[model samples]
Target: MRVLFVAAELAPFAKVGGLADVAAGLPPALARLGLDVRVAIPKYRAIGERAQDFASAGTFPVTMGGKDLTCSVSQGIIPASDVPIYFLGHDPYFDRRGIYGEQNEEYPDSLARFAFLSRAALGLGPALGWLPDVIHANDWHTALAPVYLRAGAVDLMSRSVLTIHNLAYQGWFPIDQAAAVGLNEAGRKLVASGRQLNLLRGGIQAADWITTVSPTYAEEILTRGEGLEDALQARRDSLTGILNGIDTSVWDPSTDPHLWAPYSSTDLAGKVVNKRALQEALGLAPTAAPLLGMVSRLAEQKGFDLLLVAFERMMAFGIQFVLLGEGDARYASFFRDAEQRYPGRVRALIEFSEPWAHRIEAGADIFLMPSRFEPAGLNQLYSLRYGAVPVVHATGGLKDTIRECDPVHDRGNGFLFAEYTAEAMLEAVGRAIRLWRTDPEAWRKLVARGMAEDHSWNRPARQYCAVYERVVAR
Candidate 1:
């Protein structure tokens, strides 16, 4: 089967979030199953530097506002996989410093940029003389691909599958701009939602199949009415929530080069060494205080506001806190102030470092991810692999992945709370801390069990393959 993946970001090449990781990881896994899978993404400024070899495949004209805009296609091989990655080169649209935008502002021409990308992706198969059986589009960026396909842009024998990584971003724009992106009367009807052109809604309406990251997230979107719950409910029969899997090769603690000491589930002594190393690196006193690690975008959706509300109280328990991430000026400033207010107790690296992420996962006794609504988090899965007991809110993939620690049965993997309040978060953290301070044997069992579980892409890949087959059959 021939599959073409259309996404905004592809990991190691272009990445803003987990969407990139999914685009990069899933294609290779699909290829291993004997499916001919390829990925198509815009050739952004950052990707040009890392993409090794690139030969021009030719240019095609995309119609926008009754004018022909030329888009060049370039081919390159993914470093360690057999999957081919196609770059849609349009300097005016994608040759920017940031993929979506910079400084917490989206570019006004985002509609034109991604609309061109969606049209260009559909144009690639015909240009290359290799029509795919399935075209899998990811998130709002490439959401218009399914719309384009259904609008008779291409005559290829292809079925479209749209995966909603996060339903919050719906690629909304003024209805006036619809015609510029080739949204005809029919396309506009599918996309229109109260005077706005909803790109994700268009995809959901046109795609043969719709999928979200996790089963819990799939059900939550329908119930939460997160703006598109009505549209989602309309196509409930077609929607399926497939839980995302992490790339084990990249997240494995045993072979990770960023770790202070490499260790597996069995030899947990290295975890203690890594903890001490992290304590020294962050300038925190090497006491037995339970170290809480957090690596996330400092935004309200990630529950940073709640964390800030309970920060002082949580710190009063004598637990050391370390944070590494950059997002939202308010949260960034607050966390930086926390470092100064409580020296040696709170360490906030207001930036993103891949090494630090791995170190934190390996070193910290407990990882915190109290997201208000997480689609499918990779960190909690990584935390489990590293034996870092996760203290996540019971929602979305966090609920799917982390089981609440059962002290009696000694079967659960992590600590979970149901509510989205600061008090609830503190209570969950307190539970984890109590487990760490009191019962060493049970804590070891919890960590060991988490590490033993499989979160690899193998099973999810097979599930996706089955979905592909079903979609193709339809």
Candidate 2:
């Protein structure tokens, strides 16, 4: 099958989150499964030496706000992967210092920037003389691709699949820009919900198949509290939620060059060397107390606010804490205060470093993920592969991946808390601490179970291929 992947970010070239990891990782896995897959993303100025510019595949006209605009296409390859990546080289839109946001806020031209990209991908298909059997669109950025194809790009008669990474970011815009998106009159009529340009809703309505990152998340979106309940429930039957997978080759700690010691399920003693190294590097007190780690964006969605409250309660357990990430000001200030108040016990880095992230996964005895609503988490899987048990809030992929440690039979892989509250988090941490102190054999068994678990993209990629085949067959 010839599959065209339309995304805003792909790893190595440009990456901001898990979506970039998926864009870069999944295609190669699909390629291994004997499918012809090619990825297309914007040729943003943020891309570095790895990005190579190709000759333009001619110009494609885009109608934006009744104005004619031309977009040029350039092609490149993601290093190490055979998959070809097409870049929409429009200097006016994608040429910027960063990928998505300026500082903390999103750039004002996000709508137009991505809208042009959606149209450009469709326009390039014909220009390059390659018509894909399936067009797989990702997130709110490429939501309009299916919409534009439905409008008049009939040459793109191949079926389309739209995957929602996060239902919260719906790519909303002004109603005036809706027509410029190439929606038909009927399409416009269906989307005129009190003067909002719901780009994702249009894609959900247009695509042949719809999918989210996890089964729990697919069900969550149908609820009123989910924030995108209206459209999710509107297209209930078509949506499939396949849990996201980790690229085990990159995440595995046993052979990772980033760690101080490489260890696996069989030989976990080397993990302690990693822990000692982490304590020295982070300037922590360097105690034998179980080192708990957290690596994530310090945003409200990540449950950093809950961590702020739970840490005070958790301090009584006598465990040391370490955190690494960059996000909102409130959380940043809160972590800074944690550094001051707890001194030797709690160490917080407000900025993100890739090496530090790997250290946390390899060294820390336990990893914390108290996300308010997680579509799918990648770091937790990394921690599992590194022999670090996870303490995750039971939501989305966290619910799917973690099995709360079973003190009785030692059956569970990690610790889990269902309620989205600070107190609940405290309770779960307390349970994990109890397991660490009172039951060494049980704890080691849990660690081994997590390490042995397969969090690979290969299975998920095959599932995606199945979806593609089904879409094309229709």
Candidate 3:
């Protein structure tokens, strides 16, 4: 089976979030299963700077908005793997400093930019004489690929699969711009809702199969709708929810290069060294207080507002806090003020740094995630692998991945709370703290169990291959 992945970002080359990580990791895992898998992404400015060797494969013209835009295709390989990676190079659309935008705001021309990308991705296969059996499109950025294919823009035997990474971003635009995306009469009708063009909705309506990152997320979206729930419900029979898996090779604490000292489930002495090093780096006095780490965008969806509400109360438990992420000016300012208020106990770095992220995962004793509505969170998975007990709200992937610490039965990996409230989060944190301070043996067992679990891509890859086979069989 030949599979072509259409995505906007690929990790280690161009990344804005977990979508890039999935794009980079999934194809290779699929390749190991004896399936021919290839990935295609835009040749953004960052990708050119990071990816090493690339020779021009060919060029093609994409007709959009009554103009023919020339697109260059560059051939390369995914780092550490032999899977072929094709870059669609169009300077005006892709050669920018930021992948999507500079600040929090999205680029105004994103519709046109990604519309060209969807068209170019479909055209590239024939240009290279490597047509795929399945074209898996990801997120709102590449949602239009299925739409274009449904509109007969490309004559291929490929079946289209649309993966909804996040339902919040539906890519709604003025209906007048429908033609700009090369939408035909049927395509326009499929995407039109009132006076807007809903790209994600169109993909759900057009694609052979629809999938979300996790089963719980898939169910939550249908219930909450986020606006497109009705559309999702209408296509319920076709949708499947497969839980995402992390690249264990990149996240294994025993062999991680970014750690101060390597440690495993057996010997946790190195974890102690890492904790002290992290405290020194963050300018907090090294103490026995449990360190709680958070790496997330400071946004309402991530429940940063709840963290802000519970900050003072949470600090009263005699714990050290370290956060590394940047989003929302209000949350940034609040966390910074928190550092000022509690000089030796609180530290916040309002930026995204790879090394710091790995350090927090390896060093911190507990990780916090209190999302209001998470589709599928990656940090909690990373925290589990690093033996940093995750205290998360019971929703979506967090619900699926984490089980409440049950000392009586010697089961459950981390802490979980059902209510999305600050008090509930504090209660969960308190339980983790109690375990850390009182029952050292039980805490060790919990940490060991979390590390022993398999969160790699092997299982998820096989599930995806099954989806591809089902789609082709249709």
Query: Which residue pairs does candidate 2 place in steric collision?
Result: none
Off by over 4 Å in 3: 50-52
Predicted candidate 1 versus true structure: per-residue lDDT over 323-372, tens digit per residue: 99988989989988988998888899999888999999999999999999
Model 1: ten consecutive residues of lowest lDDT: 47-56
Give the whole-model CA lDDT for all candidates, comma-separated: 0.90, 0.83, 0.90
lDDT score of residue 435 within candidate 3: 96
Q: How does candidate 1 fare on TM-score? A: 0.98
- How do the candidates rank by lDDT, highest first? 3, 1, 2
Model 2, C-alpha of 426: deviation from truth (Å): 0.8
Model 3: per-residue Cα lDDT at residue 429: 94
On lDDT, the stronger of 1 and 3 is 3
Q: Candidate 1: what lDDT?
A: 0.90
RMSD of 3: 1.0
Ranking by TM-score: 3, 1, 2
Residue 380 C-alpha lDDT in model 3: 92
For each candidate in turn, the TM-score is 0.98, 0.95, 0.98
RMSD of 1: 1.3
